[model samples]
Target chain A: MKRFQQNIRKVVPYVPGDQPDFPDMIKLNTNENPYPPAPEVQEVLAKSNAEQMRLYPDPTAHQLNAAIAEAYGVEEAQVFTGVGSDDVLAMIFQTFFNSDLPILFPDITYAFYPVWCDLFRIPYEVQPLNEKLEIVPEDYYKPNGGIVFPNPNAPTGIALPSAAIEEILQHNPESLVVVDEAYVDFGGETVLPLLKKYENLIMVQTFSKSRAMAGERIGFAIGSVELIKALHDVKYSFNSYTMNRSALDAGTAAVQNAAYLQETTARIVKTREHTKQVLAEMGFRFPDSKSNFLFVTHPDCDAHELFEALREAHIFVRWFDSPRIRNYLRITIGTDAQMESLFAFLRAYLKK
Target chain B: MKRFQQNIRKVVPYVPGDQPDFPDMIKLNTNENPYPPAPEVQEVLAKSNAEQMRLYPDPTAHQLNAAIAEAYGVEEAQVFTGVGSDDVLAMIFQTFFNSDLPILFPDITYAFYPVWCDLFRIPYEVQPLNEKLEIVPEDYYKPNGGIVFPNPNAPTGIALPSAAIEEILQHNPESLVVVDEAYVDFGGETVLPLLKKYENLIMVQTFSKSRAMAGERIGFAIGSVELIKALHDVKYSFNSYTMNRSALDAGTAAVQNAAYLQETTARIVKTREHTKQVLAEMGFRFPDSKSNFLFVTHPDCDAHELFEALREAHIFVRWFDSPRIRNYLRITIGTDAQMESLFAFLRAYLKK
Candidate 1:
């Protein structure tokens, strides 16, 4: 049976955060926005023609592409959309990170990066983040096939300034630099403006966190026409109709409602700050977070024990069992009421 | 610029038929079911909770999987779903067709097979169909990594019997045999019953044609638990949340209303037979089609010229420029009224 498997296909898959459905649960595990999508998105869904579903959706997804481009002030040709950031990043891995040279990424970043590398048979090297979980841009200056990391690195929520990203992009002129901004809209800055100077810079973002449409599965990449074209060439070959009609219509409507994105992310950022202060009062230590999630470690409590306790109490938060971040709990910033319940439970657990 | 791409990503893409949105034009190019999906699917879409879009969809898509399992009388573990049949087939190519040995398929079958082979860098051999445009079962007896072909084949809507399929499956126990039954519900018999006899037999089907939901993008595969596990391993590594919430809900609704599938496909089969008779009367030649489309060629007219004339007359049908089927047109069986309009034009043109 082992002989039947391909060497490249042998991979331990990335484990996504638990999606438990319970009436009384306080869910803050995955970094999904705690708000519904814009009202316009709902309106779009209501008015969508069911009869049109019999035909194939637009293969190019022109309306959504145009919406994204208009919002970001980029050309439509510079935008590439997929099912999610995972799909976009996978396509990027297949398109750009194929050389014999190892691509570089942070050791404690999004776990999906390594899985994709393994899936595509791409060689990759992990540059360790500093003790504060901050990415050392200089560490990525070495020669490599490509480089990629979340903007505000996942599970850590620490962000690198756009200037640092530009410096890294400047040093690696020949290789592509992928800045996954899945969490950037929470509070962090974007490297989108640098696209004018660096043609090899590919900034990926998702509607899951800010625009709040994770279940709809909309993610995209913005870059120079050359880079976008390369992604499109590989994407069309893989699956032309990657975006469904509902996603196309709903995502376009969400993008058009920029004010809604701003308001919801603002609320999450506020709640994230309040949660940070509460954690500090409870003797938790962590770096300042720019994203919607907080990565904190309590000196007295074991993360695994607390994770199980919280699960029993119907409060779901993420605790990675990896060696590097085993002691840390990555908690998403949910609504104000949900955060209050989580904090109250934490205080009681600490006392117990 | 060419040096930036991997050798495997460099290939011509499959050209899908034109999806021109015109209110007055007749669309029979792509083999999409002209009827709308079941009314229950529309109800599901309308009543879907907008707030639920904020969270990630079930990575396993258990509801849709259960619906498919119930429909096929298989266990839930034996079912796997994806964005579309193309996505399912691409994953199949990546997961099961990775050996150094070449896989086998018909030369004039689905055009996407070679494209998938090219994308995955999988070695393959195209066995030519018999003079009557039928697959020769004995030709596939050679050693191969895997085997895959549409059951009623494509463009050429000829079907091989279940006994013939079993003969091919019996000869190839070491490798996986994929039976793509995309058009089976139209008129052909399904080999799903053979799953009990052969663990290596994997059957792939889609809701795009028979259930009338191509724009929603739902496809699945049914096989032994071992084969399904291998596919899940690859799928989880690639994209965890491949199906969106609406697709999950709507596809489940579509499958539950099996009566709709039976009615629509029966209507298509009736229209297909009528179109074939009309074509034969007008000096056209084709095989006895068992799918929703007819592959026909006129003895007195050039296919390319006829296709162009049809396009100019606001009717769209597919024409391939490939050497094997260059003189043939693949006309999708539309609603009876649309088919009558097509026949009316053909009659006047042939008389001229």
Candidate 2:
């Protein structure tokens, strides 16, 4: 421990979700998509020439970024991709946020934000969510170096309206306002259209959730050409070929088959709606989520107790150890069969 | 540009050798292996399933690290692999060396060191190589927080004996002496054994050169468990799956075929010997190299002019813009046929 930087010592590591080896569990933790990626992804990956593996992947990830740009209606220069959204976020933190001024983020959102800030020796101020567990745009008006929080914000699955995001961008003209749209494709408004108006606006998205490519570790950012260039500089100076060649090939196929992603996301959203109705009928209080996950809490039900009981019944859900969100369970939306199993487990666990 | 970290402003990016479109040129500029990777690499990468790509790669990269540890004769806890040695080195700069204390590296070594130090806001002292282009271990004994230089010093192809390296490690008892053995398998002895004695030593090696897996982007470090743990903390805080699954699989296979690598490196070293004799016959001077590359300076010709002339003739070699090494050309050792063509080109160019 004495060998680490002073900042590293102060930071707690990011805890990824439990990747259980058992076959019986209906896995809803970590918000991974239950469905397989688009069939075209397999076709492209399988058909790739093995000889190409001898060469390094394109450092710019040009083709994948172009596909992402086409999907988001931006120029290729306005796009940047990394091994994953986490990778992209890490580079962004090191690139734009390391400053004398402190960064601002929601206290209840993705836990990795604080870890990254700590890792980069960046000062940060956490803005607490309002009483209703919503991020008020006004709260982010404080003068800071940057602001980042997931849109359709993680765990809570609440998305700020595009207009509200634009309002914050207007106020923080000098500071970079990064909107992490990791779950945006599942169900949420995106601030991608605002890139033309705001050079400091960067929207980060991942193929892991909707494209069902979490294992492939592909994440990208859409921003003005200048902001994207900054990310590029950091990426080149850090790890040029973060994404492997196969990933580029697979990601390009996934983006090309945008309809597949849309249909799958739509199916998950439908399943989530049905699952939410089931939870509501069972007397659970939860926020109306825009993302592909539901946040639920009950007065008498202990979150950890439910989490354990669900595990016993072969269902998995994410639980936070933090003070505010510890009482709630963030359940990922899955296939109808998985959701049915999950609902059945909750009913039996609650009855006990 | 105004928004980026000021430290990165003046940083000179490393330009990798131009991979030519024509197959005729003797391709030796970037020090890539002339041979193909192991057959297992192709088979392993072919198994990259679509389902796997949909998920995130293992943040810990346990499988690749396990393979590296097994090959290097260390515990997995003492090994860490990254996208490339560049990425791993970048993490090292941020994690261990980004302090007020000045870090140290050879003046004429891997050019990326100063770029990384600048990017991470780490102040560094460049200890110049002796007149013979040899890294004197005594030069590294100074008030420093860390030390790093390629094991077989780049361009010059000079290697520091493991005993000399061990002596330096003995002197810098408190500092992290990072020996980058990117070209080690070709000739130089690895300080892997020193890992058992010195907790402060970190040795980095890559599959790119000797194993012919550059395109796959796999590099790793062998060090004491505590140092590796610190690097792991930095890795997780940055990007969990820096190594793609296919890369991990291919790298694991590459290590398993060490005998094949030994055979290929032997062939390359033979070719290097043959080429060195040819260059010497043409009145060029260079330090004797132990790796798969040659560093030569011709008295009658400007190195830049020769590089340009070679490029015009569809031959490529690396020339550093740095003042100290500008007059020299770092040529990757190619096949016998490739070297013959290079010799023909030089002979003709010199006549012109």
Candidate 3:
């Protein structure tokens, strides 16, 4: 081996949900919205539109930032966008998690957090969730580097209320508290109102979920002007033109068409409620999920076996193999017809 | 200021060429392609084409990678794609330059090189180019962290032969040598054929220049399978889905249309030769550039003054304010009609 090969950075990457390309498959592995992006997004996707692709996109992405600011009732200086939520969060980890102390996160949370910590060489400690699989906000009042958690915690989609997040922010005024509201549009309450109140608070959201543009790859953060500016500084240093021309144009349209977002997320919430009743009837237990997916565990079935069986049938769903969550399966909310198919399969399998 | 503010990572970002929004402008700045992408790109860009916006794009971006490999005559395992050359280069820095010794590069290279070193916290030494503004291959034969330089060596527009690059690669068997072929399609000699011979060699190319998709933001690297694997490990660790759906589809089409790439780049080379004669007749001195742009100095006019004058006339070109390049203006070759307009303004302005 070459001597310089030892200097190569070794890492274990986070595995995303499977995007199998087969016909007549039910894809509920990833929590993508089951609806297309807004008609405005489609209009901007027209070939005649965005023809200036020969040139680099505006390095600042002013039009997109401006549209997001206007839609969210924030100033343009308070907004920052990137390739995806993963890109945005990675930048945040690089910009804010440089302290000597270890940052804190929920023990069972979005899987990418620890991966990011290792990538940036940041020290981190995962605080365990309480008996009910929900974050104990009081546990975060200790001295630490920083704190970030998805608002409606993943794998078990129980959301902490805005008051609880505000309490944590109040207790640790010196810490950077990031609220990743990736699924808030489904049903979780957002602390977006607290962004202006707390100097250290940043709320990140994405069109990948409710606005239904996961294929387009757009995510953003809203915070104090100072914090956003700091993020922009690091972003420009890494890559000046990140969000491409089509992404900028389509994202702007998605953010402005607020009514479409509300309508689509409402449909998912309805499907989620119906699916919840069906799972309860089938003897499944789970926390009351506020997001678009349910973390379900059956009383008599093996999660991995069920995951395999469904995969064989061209149906896909997420089942984390981590220790505490091994018995559970995370199923995203799809259409009424798709949910009925899932119910039928579960009923037949349980009977057998 | 809050105590946590001290932990914030601060950096001075790179300043890209100005993208002014105006009417009837001759834009020669930033060196974007003067032609639109291939017609197949337009077909894939239809509003109804990428209708799977709700579904996450394939995390591996297999279709695009496979197409790139087949077109470039490399194995798919030896290829990696990202948002742009900047994104690819930034990831390369994070993955490879992790040693104690500083890396090496020419002093007058791509402006983003030093910015990346600062952002990634990699120590680096700048080996000054000789008086003629060309990279001397022997200067890179030092014990260092790694090495990377644009083949044509930006803002100077002078290219070295592949044999010269092979000399540096052979001398530094233990050091990683990255030959950025960003401007290769126009005329620069690419070191792609040497990938199998040197395991430490990586050749980076982008769609921003000759492919005419800067707004789409696609860049890739071809290297040894082991090195490519290392890059993918870091990229997956950072952001799994960087290339959007349209980008992947359009990039795959652009790579497959080899005839279009050759035809368009040939047109630019013709225009560049004609512009060189015009500039030389007007007493402008420059290197015999092989890339799409020319770095020229005029005896009577100030570079910054010429920049402002061109801007006032709604014409834009690049002028670096750094010490050695301060007297030179880097003009991008445009269409025949656009070149005539630039000459008309220059002749009228120079007379006064």
Candidate 4:
């Protein structure tokens, strides 16, 4: 081995979902919204002068944060922005999870949680989800450094009520509770309003899913001014200009067109409901999902085989190889036409 | 006090230059390229479909990385891309500086160096520069966890010869050495070619400077495949997709226009030389700068007072409040017309 090689940090990186570049592929693996961003976003991108890129972007990302603050009816001081929600969550973990006690989250939640924990050297413990793939609020009532989880949990798509999440928040007044609402726009109830009452509550949202701007990479956190201030301090220490100027302008435009966000989210929810009925009739068992994706399993079919078969036919869906959820498939709700194509492929593959 | 507050990892954040947004401000505080980006970059941003932002960006940032690799005559695997050079350097520190030994750099260098060490819990010691503000190769011959310093080091703009930097690399074969070439395109001698001979060497460059895309936030590191691979692992562990689609497209276009880079760099170099001669005639004394900025001090004027005076007149230049550099000013080279305006202001202010 080379002499300097021994000092390298060794760890398994978080693997993102495969993004196969195919002209005809139905890309439903990463839970990206099928619809494009608001026309105002496109207009902003087109109208902004790229020559202005000679100057550094506003380090604080003021324009985008102001728009989010206005949209949420919060003071601008309550909002913190990053490259994406992943970056925001990573910063949150780095800043708040430094205590000796292990942070707590659901075992079957987002895989990136463990990766971030490992990166920051924060001890973490995963509470098991109930047999129905539901997060039990009581399970997180124990002592912990902090607690964080997706509201509509990934791979399962089962959402806890705002009251249930508030239950966990109430039990642990001294711990920070991060409510990641990445998919809340689709249907999940948000605990955002509770931020006015809970000092340690941080609600994270993304432009990736319902807002259909994942390619532009915008996400934000809203909380008490103190928490937001602390997060900003850590973020500034890490990277000053995470978001570029064009994306900031585009995000502002997207936030201003509030009707477009509502209409696109409603369209996706309609498709999700229709798809759920179709899957139930096809003998797939699953919980009532509130998010844009469905976690499902069949009595006789092997999930790994189904995953491979779908990929072979240019249809992509997420399937985890973990212990509890190995047999389940997580399918993102696409446009009606795209979902129809997926159903046709699944039917032939399963010999329905 | 809040109980959770005790666990928050706190540190003083790096203060970036004042980006005072005024319609008629001279704006020379941050070392941004005075010229705009290549016309190809503007065309690429305008022509790319913003509706395609519904999907996530290519996690690898393939097109931009490939362009940089091709431009530098290196294999694609030898390059690692990030949001900016700051992000790249932060990742490098997290990935490589894990040994018990303290890393070493000049006392007067980029302020972010010590900030990052504090954030990552790495021990570091600063070596004092010579009276000429030049880095002494022998000063870094001691043991270190790793070494990194900007070529044409910040605020001073005094660059070391290629042989001088190679001497440090030769002496510290067991430690990783990172050469930050953020300002090298102006006139500094780059050790980029030494990558073929040294496995522990990593050269970092940015589009924010000579390429004129600071607002786009694109930067990269070039080194051996093993070191680059390690960096990607840490970066992936932190955030899977740092670059958004539009910025990646813009960066690729910028890299492809090699003629524009050369032309812009030459223009800046010409302006810098002219400014240095003009400052010399105005009784200013400083090191011979090899960058797009001049680090200068006048015998009769206080740097802080001049900084404020310039600010009042809307001609922003950088002034550091450090021990040795408190009386020195760092002025970025602007257009010929802008420099003339600065000279005119200086002549009137100094009554020269």
Q: Calculate DockQ per candidate and list them.
A: 0.57, 0.44, 0.68, 0.73
Model 4 chain B worst lDDT run, 10 consecutive residues: B10-19
Most TM-score-accurate candidate: 4
User: What does candidate 4's lDDT look like per residue over A55-86, in tens digits?
Assistant: 99998888899999999999999999988899
Flag the better candidate by TM-score, 2 or 4.
4
Instruction: Tell me how far candidate 2 lies from the true structure as C-alpha RMSD in angstroms.
Output: 2.6
- Where does candidate 1 stray beyond 4 Å? A1-9, A13-17, B1-9, B13-16
User: For residues A1-352, what per-residue lDDT tens digits would candidate 3 score against the true structure?
Assistant: 7867998987875555577878899989999787788988888887434347788999898999999999999999999998888889989999988898999999999988998897678999999999889999989999999999998998799999999999999988999999999999988999889987998988999889999999989999999999998899888776788888889988898899989888989999999999999999999999999999999999899999999998888879998879898999999999899899899889988999
Predicted candidate 3 versus true structure: per-residue lDDT over B215-240, tens digit per residue? 99999999999998899988777578
- Higher-scoring candidate on lDDT, 3 or 4: 4
**Candidate maximizing lDDT:** 4
TM-score of each: 0.97, 0.94, 0.98, 0.98
| Model 3 spans with C-alpha error above 4 angstroms | A13-17, A48-50, B13-16, B47-50
Which scores higher on DockQ, 2 or 4? 4
Q: Candidate 4, residues B1-352: lDDT per residue as tens digits?
A: 6668888878675554577988888988899999999999889888767779999999988898999999999999999998989988988999999999999988999988998898888999999988989888898999899999999898799999999989999999999999999999988888788999999999999999999999999999999999999988878766788899988999999999999999999999999899989999999998999888999999999999999999999999998879988999999999999999999999998994
How many clashes in each structure? 0, 14, 0, 0
lDDT of each: 0.88, 0.81, 0.89, 0.90
Chain A vs. true chain A, TM-score per model, equals 0.97, 0.95, 0.97, 0.98
lDDT of 2 by residue, B147-233 (tens): 898989897899889999999988877777889999998899999888888877889988888888777788888887877887787
Q: Residue A246 of candidate 1: its Cα lDDT?
A: 92
After TM-score superposition, what is the CA distance of residue B193 in candidate 4 from its true location, in Å? 1.3
